[model samples]
Every structure is written in C-alpha cells, then in structure tokens.
Target: MIRTEFPEALYLLILIPFFFIIHYIYIKKKKARLNNLVDKELIKTIAPEISYGKLWTKFTLLNLAYAFIVIAISNPQIGTAIEKSERNGTDLMVCLDISNSMLAEDIKPNRISRAKQSLNNLINQLNNDRIGIIIFAGSAYVQLPITNDYSAAKTFIDVIDPSMISNQGTAIGEALEIANESFGEKNKNKSKSIILISDGEDNEEEAVSIAKK
Candidate 1:
C-alpha cells in the first residue's frame, strides 16, 4: 500500500500550471518588446540558437522535475515486509459463552450480544496477530480454526447463539479444552492465550484444572 506522509503538499501541484501561464505571459511580453526593438526576421537571424520550441520544451522539463521534487517532499511510502522484525504478539483464542443464560437482559440487551460486539471490537483493534473463536455451552466446539483471518472470525462470531449448541449448560472446562485443541500443535511454542468471556458461571468444577494445563 502506497501512503503519503505529507498529503497536503500535493496542493503544490496547482502551482505548476500557474508557473506555466506566467512563463507564457513573460515570453509573450519579451517577444513584443523584441519586435518593437528590431524586425522579427532580423531578431531570429541575430539569435538563431534561441528556438521558441526548444525554450518551451526546456521549461516543460524543468516544471516536470519540480513536480517530481514536490512529490518526493510529500514522502510517499510503500508497505514493507515485516519478516525481519521479531514476532512479539500472542495468538489469541476467544472462548465465548453462548449458553441460554447469556440471553438474559441483565447486561443490557443480553450477555451474548454484548460479548459478540466486544469481540468484534477486539478483532478491529488487532494487527497481524492470529485469532480464532470457540463457542461453548454444555459442550464446546471451534467455530473458527486458529488463523490470521480476522474477517472470518467476526463472521463466525456474528452467527453465534444458544441454538448452535444443543447442550444446555455452561461447561467452562470443556470449552477451555476445546479452545486449547483449536490452537493446534504448530503454535504451541509461540506466545498464546485463551480469552474466556463468560458471566462467571461455571457448572464444571474442572475449569480451573483445565486452565492450569
């Protein structure tokens, strides 16, 4: 992606045409003064090296060079590969609670709806980090495999509801396990995190143990 650091400098381009017009006027006045001082044919014979076409061509080239200089001053930049930079960001897996209890309007509209909105906002703030989603109720499943496809993550998040899972309780431990599995073995060595967004309701006592693993 090409970006200009000083986009306002592009307004200087308008000066190019103004410069040409002024030069044209100056050239016309010079010609008029020269015609008054000497015959046109005589002037041409006296200054055979001064071709009007060549002068105009030189001015055009100079103006183009000036335009290029102005553009350079604007500091146009191109996107560069970040392969050499150290990989510092974490791979995030969001484990969202989509149980029927999330449908309660206690948190304005519902917990599940608010969670989805917050997740979407979180996705918007990410840069280059891989993200995935896990929806859980009585059981858990990977709604999206871990990847850098943030758009797909949001898409999966938008469609999440209690109906997606037939099981009818909040199994935080099973959800944590499913989220762990979804991360895959390839990213195990890398910085990773599972964000469990629930209403502090855990029916399964094994959640703490699963999280420790």
Candidate 2:
C-alpha cells in the first residue's frame, strides 16, 4: 500500500487555513475602503457574479492539490520488494586457559573465572559465526568441537573451571597443535580464526608458529 514516508510533513496543512484567513481579511479591508469611496450598490451591480466564498474554495482546492503533489514526489512505493538477506560467517575457535595459576585472584574473582565471564560476553556479541571451544590447563582438550551452535559454545565455556583439567599446567603449544589438527581436516578455505584468551602466563610460542602455517 502507498504510504507517506514523511508523515510529519502533513502538518503543513495547518498553514493553508491561515493563508486563506489572511487573504480574506485583506479582501474585506479592500472592499470596505472601496465602499467608502464609491457606491456599494454600484460595485455590487458591476460584479454581481463574484463570490468570495467561491474564491476561498478555489484557494483551498489549490493548496490540497499542492499537498498531494508534494506527497507523490516523496515517491511512495506500494508492496515494494525489500529484500532481506543473510551472510555466511567465519569459523572461530575460543581457546581459554584453565591452569592453576588462573585461580590466583590477580584479576576480579580469579583469572579463570574472569576468562569464562569474558568468553560469555564475547559469545553474546557473535551473530552467524561458527565457533569451537578449546580448554587447556597442563595439557589440551577440545571441550566443544567447531559448530554454529552459539548456545552450546556458551554452555561449554561456562562449565570450564580449574578442576576440568586433571594435571594443571599451562601447555599452550599442545592446545594449538590439537586445534590445528582438528581444523585441518575441515574445509581450510573458510576464514578460520582462533582467539586465545589467557593471561599468557604459561603458554608457549609453538601456538603462533602452528597458526602461521
């Protein structure tokens, strides 16, 4: 259906009556002056057919026509095909640190707990990205495989604590290696990114090298 995109513009209709009233006042004052100068009966006899009511009506119609034209120029489209589209997203992995040092209260609550909270907040911002979870302490383990289920990712992140890893030490290298191997079997053509969230206290340089390759 045709609609006014600028409906607020319709308030200009109020001016039309004001303009008509001003014109009527001017015409009345002019007629009074003419009547004082000349015979009112003679003026009526000269222009008996002229009606101010008809003039006012004509002016009102002209304003209406102008308003309609202005509204049309706004380009009202009816039942327009407004296309809504979705885009395929990137493959992302969130590597979280679950080492014993993370239990230290250097950060709010602790490092590991703070990391989990940050992960939850990060997940909240994602839209269509396929994500995975890799929790590493002394060794590495894929807590959740790569999937588009954001809810599942958040669930896995929330459950991760210091107790999740049996032997607690930070092995950032092995975690990266596991992640690289896991991602290798999949389609490598897609945009793959791994976000390592940690205090960088116990990880190794091997993760950078493996990710580079």
Candidate 3:
C-alpha cells in the first residue's frame, strides 16, 4: 500500500507559513533601510523592475517548489502491487478469562474490558502469525480455531462476554487444555505460544501442570 510510515511528519505544513512570515518581515526591514539611505525617486529609478506584486509571485512559486521538495524528501512513493511469496510463522493461541471476577470494576471499565483492549493492541502488532482464541469459565470451548484469519479471531474475541457461557467460575485448566487441543494437525515444528489474559484471582493447580506440558 502507498502508506506513509511517518504521517506525523506532514505537520511540517505548519512551518511553511512561518517561513513565509519571516521572509516577509526580512524583506520589509530591508526595504525600510533602503528608503532611509536614498530618495524615493532615486530608489524607484534604481529598481523600477522590482514590483512588490512580482516579488510576491516569485515568493509564492518558491514556496510551492519548497513544498514539492519537502514531499519528495518525505519519500512520496507510488504503491506497486507486489506478489509476495508466502512465509510461514508461529502458531499463537490466546486464552482469555471469562469468569465473574473478570467483570469486577477493579480496572477502569472492568478487568475483562481492559484485557480486551490490550488484546486488540497486540493483534495490531502481528504480521504473519497464525492465531487462535479460547475462552473458559466453568467449561471450555473453542472460541476460535487456529487459522491465518486474523479478522475472524478479532470478531470472536469481540463477542466474548459473561453471558456467552452458562457457568461463572474460572476453569483455567480447561482453557489451557482446549488451547493445547487446538494445535492438533498443525505443523509440529512451528513455534507455538499461548497468552492467558486473566486477573489471577482464581486458578486451579491443574493449570500449571497443563502449562508445563
């Protein structure tokens, strides 16, 4: 895409007008000094061709050229359709806590809500990583399967709420087990990681054992 990596750099537009104002001030000061040094008639005789209107026109054109150069330095690029060869990466599964405690208003809107915001930030940083989602309370289910479809993962994450599950208790082990199962049939050699988002208030001992495996 023809995306500008440093879009904030365009704020340099603010400097353009500042430069013009300074140039105008300098020109005015110089003209005043010249007027003091000579008679009005003599000054006009010396520089009759230097019309204020023509000077302004030249300045305007120079500013335009300066703008073009700035844009060029900012690397004005034409996006080309690039057919890139596919590259494989790691499988990352995210396990989120959907328990009642997660709904506690300990953090801003709540723990669960804040966790979701953090997850959204994380997803934006990803490139080619295949990802999965699993949410569990008293039971576990495949909130999303391992896939390269990042949009689908985000959609599934957005829909996760307390009402989605019938149970209210946190079953950390169940969530881990579901995540482990989701990796079946995938390339065994690929790097795999699981990110668990929870308040760590309630967790079963089995969760540690599952994590070790």
TM-score of 2: 0.59
Task: Give all candidates' CA lDDT scores.
Answer: 0.87, 0.78, 0.82
Model 2, stretches more than 4 Å misplaced? 1-81, 201-205
TM-score for all models, in order of appearance: 0.58, 0.59, 0.57
Per-residue lDDT of candidate 2, residues 1-213 (tens digit):
667677666677667778878888987987788889879788779978767778778887888897787676565667766788886677777777877778889888988888888878878887787788888888888999988888888888878887888897778778777776666665767777887876656447776697686
Deviation in angstroms for 23 in model 3? 65
* Model 1 lDDT per residue over 1-213, tens place: 788999999999999999999999989998889889999899879988867888899999999999999999999999964567765677898898888889999898899999999999998998778898888888888888888888888888888988999978887898898887777778467888899998758867789988987
Better of 1 and 2 by lDDT: 1
Show pairs that collide, candidate 3: none
Query: Residue-wise lDDT of candidate 3 within 111-161, one digit each (tens)?
Result: 888988888788887878888988887777888888888788778878889
Sort all candidates by TM-score, best to worst: 2, 1, 3
Q: Can you give the lDDT of residue 27 in candidate 1?
A: 90
